[model samples]
Target: MRHPRLCAFLAWLYGNEATTGRILQQNQIIFPAIFWPAPENAPLDPDAVLGTFQSAPATSLPEVFELPGQTYLRNLQKISPGLWNGRTYCMKAFDLTEGRPTLTCSSGHFFDALVSCDLLEFELLSAFGEVMPEEEAFPEFCERLTLRGTLHALGNPLHHACGRSAAIGISTLIIFPAEGVYHVLLRSCGSRLAYLDKFFHTVPSLMMQPMLADERMEYSVRHNVYREYLEEVFGAVEGEMPYTPAQYHDIYADPAIQYLQNREAAGSARLLLSGVAMDLLKLRPEICTLLLIDDPDWWLTHRQRLRPVTMVDSRCGSAANLLERSPATPLYAIKLSPELELPTGLLCPERFTPPGAAALCLGLNQVRKLLLYI
Candidate 1:
């Protein structure tokens, strides 16, 4: 009721009671209950995952829906003032039309559309008593909303017109190949702007964005993944203000990055593209990937750099500090040997964010046959 435009949109997508019940029965985190797995024989290497940037005229909400959407967003900001409306990449299209997976993205911002999507999810959950909708009542509720068939026009999960902000998130599963241990982060309740107390990838998942103004028109999934790895895994912090191209160059040049790059080049490390999917709750697109370091010596040499903590340090200043603070603490590692399975205790929805759980599940699905050789 609070976000009628969003309600209208959702009604178009899942207004049928049966559809709502089916998605609920499938998975609490992601829709279709499973990721749309990457095609077999699709290029798994990062460099091979092609992306292009298009400068298109920005899209706006219909005039009839604009006021209510803006009101909802303002209310959300009032509730969470720290929400930052930074520039982010919005996926305009994704497909394998070019003989390999390619993402067509454009410039956008956080506040333009994503926060509104969050608002919609908030409203839906609120209607269900601040929880996931009951299977029986949810569909009935959706069926009641006015549907304009907007979402149905958006095509399949792989292709669609961009929303106000179709922010594409990149989530990578990090594995220490020798030990067969893959890491995951437990977001501290005292920290994180969103998804607090949820589990994410060991290396914090990042929405693709240009760190410096000079790079605004460019987008690279590999580069985005590497930057998060440097910050979260190596605690490499970038200084504030007037960022330079050199700063980013140095970041990419870090020995740790170089080490991984060399291993990837040497066939000892792999960066596989798992696939992409939209979070069921938020409708945010996410790119799933798997990074495996298959060298015993690399882990042996750098394992000490991984600082694990049971709790966030009380004096932490920024969300970045929370991520850089403990690379592996407050985390879980699913073993790769004998096939990967999350620990029994972590099999519930509450333990992980939808995108994180989807990445792990989809990444494992992409890598399962390969694990047979391991």
Candidate 2:
């Protein structure tokens, strides 16, 4: 992204202090632990409005935390700084002048009111930086907004402000059979919704699911993936969530939840694309995450499938016969790639596809040259 404005902001945000806030790229956010309140009784984050209501109250929460236990980085304290050599991780705590947002989420509903607050120990995760030692940080920036244009009615100023600040949670899964290699599925989110088309760019990669109001546990990448995958693919199961990563895997291993390929990827596959694409593989520890699973099964033949898009040549092209695609269907980006096709047949659609679909598929692939990563 031509982050000229973000660069200007960062340049000013880190005008002083050599080691602290300096970022190679505008997307790389740094939060030194020293900046955090010692007892992490932080100021409320902007997410509190939507996040707090989505989860059970602090009073009802159990002492134990549930995480994807499959991750390699066992405990944050147990691992060393050296382990983050190739990927990003929670590097070290430094100090940063926190931005005390004027608003905080109410933790009750998606459209709930934003409360006036300053301290964010509860939600503002501005204290530590998920540092990637290897790659250059090309950041992604966004502001949460409700795009109700000017003629919209607003009687209460607070309602207008909170509605304007409602957060949009954009979560993606870089499904890969092996490290650095991604499995992009073709998702047919419909030619209808303006929102889905913009975010997925009509043709997109990665599994996209927005956070529901009830998913109140603090945002964890692995858990987000696990929870979204199960609900989106398998439909929700009633029970306590698996507390350990292995338990999470056991559910995945179920024949019913067959999400992975039958076997591990045979060898490293390579691909070449003609657009602006770079693989930013930021390992755990670096991102705002609890490295949930050490390793996850990728070649999922999950039978409970979304209706595959109407492949151009497929005889079953009637409108009534097809299903509107889910965000997970962006796998078409992979089908378009000549180099990275897997050995499996179900994964690739016929090459001679529809021109309209082909155009979107290609356009999204072009954008991905800049956005694909784990």
Which digits, one per residue and each the tens of the lDDT, describe model 2 over residues 33-87?
Answer: 1011111233122122111122222111111111211122243214433322111
Q: Predict model 2's lDDT versus the native.
A: 0.25
Off by over 4 Å in 2: 1-108, 112-163, 176-182, 190-219, 234-300, 303-333, 336-374
Question: Model 2, residue 275: displacement in angstroms?
Answer: 19
lDDT at 56 for candidate 2?
21
Among these predictions, the greatest TM-score belongs to 1
lDDT, candidate 2, at 302: 39
In angstroms, give how far residue 144 of model 2 lies from its true place.
Answer: 20
